[model samples]
Target: MIRFAVVDDHMIVHDGLQAMASRADDLEFVGAAETPDDALALLEETRPDVLVLDLRLNGESSTELCATVRRRHPDVIVLVFSAYGNTELLTQAIRAGAAGYVLKDTNTGRMPEILRELVRAGSYFDPRIAGSLLLTSISNPSEPVSFSERELAIIRLIARGANNHDIGEALNVSPHTVKFHVSTMFKRHGVHRRAELVRLAMDLQLLD
Candidate 1:
């Protein structure tokens, strides 16, 4: 079973998610919490495979919580399930190590399937927020950036949702090489996260 935990301040959301997970034969509703501290404790106790987290937990920054969880328990994947559609917050969450970002307004019926895909694929993003991310990247009027053909190839792989390991295998390079290139790309684009890099590449039409 794909064991999961929920960290949302709303009891209603928690109950709804719990009920949804309980109905899915492949999913296990591990536990729920209303604050970052409580979520950390619950995660420590349950050691769930995935964490369904809210962007705001009792008015605290859930992005930081995601970073902390990732630092403390790298095995537990974090999926940001929030009502807010702020692209800045989404970017921060991605940078903080959330593997997925799904808006709560999305059909709750699809959450289990999304969570399953996230656990299987290692990354996911809500369609509703994707356009905004692209727009955000495009709106940033930085000096024009250029990339080499190989860098463009890697960016295309990233745009297609390939992780560093997958990119390394596809390019017949070591993961370290892929990391080096990605880091170089990040510095060139003045971005710090994979999601941002992909979005910027899309904005530049580099993936075309």
Candidate 2:
């Protein structure tokens, strides 16, 4: 049987998944959590083979938690179960070491098969984003992302733990402008959080 845990805030998701697992002879619902901290605790306690993660937990992106799970629990396959079909978010999940991305709108009956396929093939992506993902992979996937001087400045400030307001003040720009730049950078870099963007910049030697 495939033992799986979940880290999504919605009780409906938790209850629905549990019901699905109960109906599937090959799947087991090990546990569930509504927060990242609880998710960590549940993982440590259950050590399940798979994790069904939501892209957003309490309005915050859970990609970092995905990375942490992969790092600390290498054997557990992190499967993203999100309502979003945003290509950048999907890219971020892939970069964070997720094994699959399944949309919430997908037929719930197919979930068991999807999980099994993920375990066997080692990766799965929603068909809705497959075309874009393919194009992205075909189009210079190895090329480094380019950032403007202003963006670099904003990134540096972000690395120093500056919020939007602080970065805007430092750069003599409005917070809204700073937000726009940051959001654009997030999409361009396929990262969800400031920390991830800073790390990517450092990896590419963009931040000195």
Q: Rate the local accuracy (lDDT) of all candidates.
A: 0.83, 0.86
Scored by TM-score, the top model is: 2
Model 2 misses residue 172 by how many Å? 19
Q: Provide the lDDT at 76 for model 1.
A: 94
101-192: candidate 2 lDDT, tens digit per residue = 99898988999999899888988888877677777778978854467899999999998999999999999999999999999987755568
Model 1 scores a C-alpha lDDT of 0.83
Candidate 2 local Cα displacement, residue 59, angstroms: 0.3
The total of clashing pairs for model 2 equals 0
Q: Tens digit of lDDT per residue, candidate 1, span 96-123?
A: 9999999888887998889889988998
Estimate TM-scores for all models: 0.66, 0.69
Query: Cα lDDT for residue 16, model 2?
Result: 91
The list of candidate 1 runs beyond 4 A from truth reads: 138-208
**lDDT of model 1 at residue 41?**
98
